[model samples]
Target: MVSISDYGDFYKMAKRNIMLAILGFNAQKHFCDTRERMVSNVLSSLHKLVAVDPHSPLNFREVYTTELFGLSLIQNLGEDVCSVYVEEFGREISKEEIFHVLVHEILSCVVEPDWRDYFPYLSWLPNKSFETIVSSTEFRRDAVMNALIKRQKERIARGEARISYIDFLLEAKNSTQLTDHQLMLLLAESIAAAVDTVLEWLYREIREVCGGKAVTEEDLPRLPYLDAVLHETLRLHSPVPVLPTRFVHDDTTLAGYDVPAGTQVMINVFGCHMDEEAWESPGEWSPERFLGEGFKLADRYKTLAFGAGRRTCAGSQQAVSIACVAIARFVQELQWTLREGDGDKEDTMQYTALKLHPLHVHLKPRGS
Candidate 1:
């Protein structure tokens, strides 16, 4: 049940570097290429919409996009992590099902009343109920990780190795000094780190930049506006509004105040992104802010969407590549209009920010 956060500083640094190498450009390029092929397959089925009666609007809602993008993300990650496709009851597991369980369990832990928050001196008290709930959730999460890791070990024993996170970890098992439990937790953390939308201006950008051809990763450099749209979307609605808590092992000072050792600190991503000091008209959705010459991608701390510093998200590049290409392709092929009455739905947050009501949209083939 130990997470990467529980590791010593050296172990944490080593683990992060391994993740960085696994999720670096070269690996991401391969993952993105695989995802694009999968996306093309999915889009192929949707292409029939071109011939659907122009007067009819296709009902594209949360369920549809969740499957489209979620499946793509998890399947690609699954392959890259262990060369396995996760399934249950002989069918592929849906992203909604996985998140529904994981998020609920996680949120339960976050909201559940705990005495430690009120009485640090009484922290020695046993909280059996909380412990039981956490244990159950960990079991569920670990089952998948164990299965994947076991399969990779079997593959390695058979001398059928592939370049993947699990394969890499299995090969370095002894040298890295990571016990099976730590390795599983590290892999789980990496998976968690790897876990996108905007359309209007994007539609215009794709049409202008890509023309009749579907957009590719090569087109990303030419579509600054599209990148702006993505950044703005994240700024306005970060997936993880609150970052994972960081434990302070040694007392430190921040801005002005002292943070004692053993302190758990959480960064408010939503607040940082909306800071008036850092952004003009902070409350408004303006992608142009990111388009300025001052904004440099090399500055990792510029925005906290993917986090900052040595622990910045390992999958940031992979996420951007996948999202940019997928979005461009969708815009290039389909026209999206928010469905009637769905615009007023406020966002809700759990493990990530989500729509209070599912986003329903009307879709028609582009140029129709």
Candidate 2:
């Protein structure tokens, strides 16, 4: 229960969360070297591949995840880096499979048209297909998450001090009232924050903004075009497109229709951002729309990237910060090219957000 007018508690929680992950300025100092080095190596290798053969298709699923989230989990965070993840209640699973399962789970929770949702009387009956997915996804998520929890437990028992998202959350669990399930979900959600799918233009922007210098968090604000690109991206391909929902306190009218009290209402963020009335050409990709006058304080609603209003995402700012800094730095250091020969139009990908198929790209070393 929180006041709609106040966000102090939310801000405090967000502040504390920065410590849980390999996030924020102070905590980043500890593992920045490993993460940066790994990223640099990956970028260099890609650059060599593209330089050798420009049209070679690259697999970006693992590549992107490893850069943004995996290093924080595997290299210095989770134990048994060589061993695959396992569950306290289920069996073992591989690192490669974790992100895929996470996307599936996210898809399942979205407020799509379902008979069971509209008709509570049919609740007893289950959609076998969906049931199977849920059953499978629950096990996989638990397997990956539970395995991490167990590893941290073992580390604690062996008197080994680890500074990782897992360890940090474990210590703050009690004070923050974070359950094992909550901790697992936190890690689960972080693992699938995919912002590296689009690359070419961002690289150009970063290079231009930094004047061939390496992009850093401090350089993010000065790079106005890069900032606009991030904004348009979230608006177009929001990975998490729907909010959980809230109960209506009283009767209300919505677009001339009456919404009764105690009704569960959800926000379709994707729909909001895609509305033709709100956007000149919603379907097209245009970061230019967010430049100059678009970024005014009152104009934030054009893209409901992280939800809207007081009930909006608590970590919206942090999420954008991470995406901008990471993508900018990556783009600044390396260059990527689309490989059309490997496959046809990747117009439709079947992931949680309907993203492009993870494909290989040619890369070249960057002056920046």
Q: What C-alpha lDDT do the candidate models reach, one value each?
A: 0.65, 0.62
Per-prediction tally of clashes: 0, 2
Q: Which RMSD values do the candidates have, in order?
A: 4.7, 5.1
Candidate 1 global TM-score: 0.80
Best by TM-score: 1
Error of 1 at 244 (Å): 1.6
RMSD of 1: 4.7
Give the runs in model 1 whose Cα sits over 4 Å from its true position: 1-17, 45-115, 194-200, 292-301
Candidate 2 lDDT, tens digit per residue, 1-368?
12122346744573457444555556656655655555565566566665777655666555656555456455225542434556453465555555455554555543234577778888898787666656776776667666666777788779886776676767778888877776776666554434244466666666667776666566777877778788887787776566556778789999998999978886777788789998878887787788776557555566776666655654465566666766676577656565665445333322235435566665555653
